[model samples]
Target: MIARWTSTILAAACLLAAPVLAADLRPGTAGEGNFRVNVAASGGPSELPDRIGPVSRIKDIATLLTARDNQLIGYGLVIGLQGSGDGLRNSPFTEQSIRAMLQNLGIAMEGGQARAKNVAAVIVTANLPPFVQSGARIDVSVSSLGDASSLQGGTLVMTPLRAPDGEIYAVAQGPVFVSGFSVQGQAETLTKGVPTSGRIPSGAIVERQVDARFNDDTVLTMQLRNPDFSTTIRVTDTINAYTQSRFGKRTAAEQDSRTILINRPTEVSAARFVAELENLLVETDTPARVVVDERTGTIVIGQDVKISQVAVSHGQLTVRITEQPQIVQPAPFSDGVTAEEPSTTIDAQQAGGQVAMLEGPDLQTLVSGLNRIGVKPDGIIAILQGIKSAGALQAELVLQ
Candidate 1:
């Protein structure tokens, strides 16, 4: 019973930790603990510009259009598990894969099933980098594809990773290194992070080169990480100015808000020209944005986010209901039996709202104004959403 309970707990924890969401948890229970809303605030002495300010290198904000990593995925087998592998009765595919592998290895069984408790089926994933040589190795990630309890001490078999085009680009085979761990005992089990997935650093060797001729290309395209007209214009102008000064020719042209075309100069190779252009510093512009993650109570305020002159009132109304049951007995010699009397009490408490003017010329000013209201993160999220609905928030309000 204890083992079953521990297994149940570990299974649930693994499922919950699969997709990670950073959250700040408080020490409290659902009904008996007190919960408060908290909003973080920061201040600066001077207000920053609304649109344009900090200078960034070209490479930091943009990348070559053709230079990118290709995703590779493959079905693989992970062996050397300590009784944590998938059961053939539960996952039939794992059994099939094992059978196929053993048949290929010239080890065929006359029986119906060759049961194994130290093997698991897994999916291997890796990225084939552009301009990578054939012998260069890249990191590979392994995820359990079957009902494996943990992939803690497993070694991945030789798996051929392929691109979406069905062409093999790399081969992965190594011992899996799991960052998280699971501990089990007779009565209890504890799991930290996830043990069903692991990473093997420099495990996959590139089998083929990506189809990219970056150094020999004639027309080079630069793609912006974030699309902005002002930023595009600034980038194009900077590149053109730098080229006109150094090479005595205008080689850079804006193709779109997100794309910039540069004509590879005849005197310089594409690699040298790109190397020179990416280092040039230029200012970048981003749209005013306010990012709020409702699940985690995380609020990220952009530098350009602003709020118009508006009055905000912050308060909360809490209603509590409690029930009490009392057993009543009859007096001596009376013909009354025991009875239960139910008593319930309902109470409502409302906090007075404090109204204050909120106007932000900069992020610091806005944060300071919000801090004055003493609204917590949850309350501040509501206030921000309300402000956006009222069209008072100048930045784009994004809720996650």
Candidate 2:
């Protein structure tokens, strides 16, 4: 009776485990989808003329084309460290800088006797904006140049930041705001992120301004970072239309995908003229591109993505193995020893489901089909690769 009950329980357990194993299997359809299509015009010529700016005005567009900030960098020293600074023994520059600073402070030190653990070498960086006047404050970044453990609670002592022209543009000085912390004991130390670098908000004052002329040019230029011919033409047409209705004739010229030349208006100030140009509305078109990041399983779909007619089927194949151990006992108390023998079996089977099909004729249908099949990101990559191989996918496949 006991043997019969045990066998029944073991069979039930095996039946229960089978469904869990089956749940692990998945089926997915693989194919490439097209991304090229005609983008419908949104917000017409009236919208276009306002999106970019005025056509007769030259100064406003030029201002919009300028760089946001100028990069200023310098090498400096960080002092008053709590034994967390770089070792002077290994870094001779740290010691040399410290000696020079102390000598300025009227403390004479012998060459070999200037070793100290409170000093660190650092690099100072800041950004000078186009309209930054003298005495304007800007944020600055400070990073250790040596093997300093941390820069927390350290003060930057008046580091002069210079631009590419080797002229001092800003002066940086303040308490450094390090992002990480560290603690140490005799046996163990705990650290998080990086404490050797820090930032100071509004810590630098602009000392010099870059000599740049924005309103002096007779022809102002609008430059696009990613020059698209369609976008450039739209910008040019929009500016021309605005000026024709407002100032009498077209004054904006599309020089190329990257540049547009506008004739300055005599009636408006350069600043106000450029302001009106920047407000012009121009509808721009971007190329159809499919970007795939395999490492993180991210997919970005543009609105213009399209797909031709295609069929897709997905299924899964599974293989399973089972092992059972049987025990043999000596009969009737005889002097025979008991032993156990193991039985093993292998089985292969297809998933108990119908294959899913994807039929796509356009971008909407393609996205709907992929979503309906519940395709994962990694599986999407495989499908895209397969589609590309078939010469059906129209967009550029950039895998990163």
lDDT of 2 by residue, 1-400 (tens): 3233222211111011112222111111011122111112322332333233223223332334432466778767777888888887788777777766666566778755765677778888877777677889999999998988989878887667766555556777789999898999999999987899999999988877665455544456577655767677777777778877888867776666777666766676656767777876556566666788999999876545555555655545778999988898989869989899888889988752444565555568878878876667777777777777776677777889
Screening candidate 1 with a backbone cut-off below 3 angstroms (N, C-alpha, C), the clashing residue pairs are 37-376, 38-376, 38-377
Residues 1-400 of candidate 1 have per-residue lDDT tens digits of: 2233222111111111122221111111121213221111111111334445889999999988656666777787899999999998998888887776766666776677858888888888887776788889999999998898899889987777766655556778899999988889999999998899999999998876765556556667788999987788788778877888898866666756898767776699778888999999988888999999999999999988989999998889999999998999999999999999999999999885878899999899999998888888999999999999999999998889
**Among all candidates shown, the one with the greatest lDDT:** 1
Candidate 2 wrong stretches, greater than 4 Å: 1-63, 66-68, 111-115, 183-191, 313-355, 359-364
lDDT of 1 at 326: 90
The list of candidate 1 runs beyond 4 A from truth reads 1-52
Candidate with top TM-score is 1
lDDT of each: 0.77, 0.66
Indicate the residue-level lDDT of 353 in model 1.
88
Residue 66 in model 1: lDDT: 52
Count of clashing residue pairs in every prediction = 3, 20
